[model samples]
Target: MALPTVPHLSQDGIAFSAVKNRPAYAIASVDSALLLASLLQQEGAMRVTDVAARLGVSVSTAHRLLGMLVYRDFAEQLPDRRYAAGPVLRRGPVQQASVARLREVALPHLRGLVEAVGETANVMVLAGPDVRFVATVESDQVLRVGDRTGRTLPAHLSSGGKAVLATLDDERLAAVVASLDAAVAVRLERELRTVRRRGVAVNDQETEAGLTAVGVAVPPSGGVTGAALSVAAPSARYSRDRLPVWKEALAEAAGGIARDLGDG
Candidate 1:
């Protein structure tokens, strides 16, 4: 049977006809496996049944293929029994190096920020349209925000993400907005303009109902593009009057990280 094909389009929206035809000697099983991997990587979590339906294969065959992908470290079964792209499939050495270096150099600054603001502080990097928390330092206060390491949130909704978004050039910013809903894209663009003017971004119960955060972009340096520093606190503890203090502390921490990256 011929493999199912989707039309490939260039940046200018021109279709590429050459890629539509399956090769003469294409192996069905190999093609199915590769296609399944692509689905997992692009669509995020999927159940076994969803995989079977998407691949036009039997449930047993889908299970076996997913098993092989798991064995090869290309996919992992989530706690909810859904499959997602695994470590191997998510690896990007250059991006990883930047994330790692940024996390390392920002730790001390994060700690300092936490001390100054008495709130949780985090370092995050933009991964596509999402922001991934790389490191976090929690405040000692009992009612403070918790560490957010390894958490991923929509870049447009996150304080750190919006701060980073404000730093992006027009073309890059447009690409990111294009991936979002029209209304959301318009709202985000307006917010980014404010972030740019103030040099700080605020997340007022956006990501979480009772949490508030303020962030500043860590200026790009040493091959790192979109990285930010944020301090989070409980909404009860947040107020407009505190913005100046929080913004100052976050800017100081972000600047320290940028300076450290420059020296390294």
Candidate 2:
């Protein structure tokens, strides 16, 4: 999840190693409240006693952690006082806390792209063999693509995934594609080739039936990065002829973001 780094932040701005080691720190903390919160994060919603037992802390310490999390909107205590991820935290689409700065940098521009294109716009990053939506701008169309923020789906069926994948050389790209089954790999190859040739990728009913999406890569970083910007519309309203328009708008938006990231 730390694979997608911050955009518009210089290399000196963040220590990549710090982010890579976050999970380890999350596991090693001895602070009772933090320990309680950590356990809840790993094992899902739990009663205060359950969290306390797992962390080997007293109920009072568990309560302290729950209170802190609730105050920070990072955890929610149910009516029964069982705890789960809170609304604000549950809404966190970017798993890499360090890279969340990228979202802040990209929001204004991404919203502008969505407005210009008159279609939904999404930003995503790789999650294993799939792509996870990190941000979205919903379409004004009455019939539109749905929000996929924080949701992961197979890369083979997503225009965004292909767009990002196209930037990789054949060796690395093949390795990424090979993680999937043969059929999925074949489709990825076909789509990625089109993405490479056209500088845009389109998904025509490959994800959900009657839903079409077009995308371009967001080169947030050079060499082996996996971030994409996508536009989606209902298939009933899409046409091959419209692809050129979509490609133009998408390329403009992606190019600007890529430039900003490179300068960083």
Pairs with backbone N, CA or C atoms under 3 Å apart (clashes), candidate 2: none
Please report, in order, the local distance difference test score of every candidate based on alpha carbons: 0.79, 0.67
Task: Name the lDDT value of residue 13 in candidate 2.
Answer: 35
Report how far residue 41 has shifted in candidate 2, in Å: 9.7
RMSD to native for every prediction? 15.7, 14.6
Would you list the clashing residue pairs of candidate 1?
Answer: none
Predicted structure 2: clash tally: 0
In candidate 2, how many Å is residue 263 off? 4.4
In model 2, where do residues sit more than 4 Å from their true spots? Answer: 1-98, 222-224
lDDT of 1 by residue, 219-259 (tens): 88887778899888877889999999999998888888888
lDDT of 2: 0.67
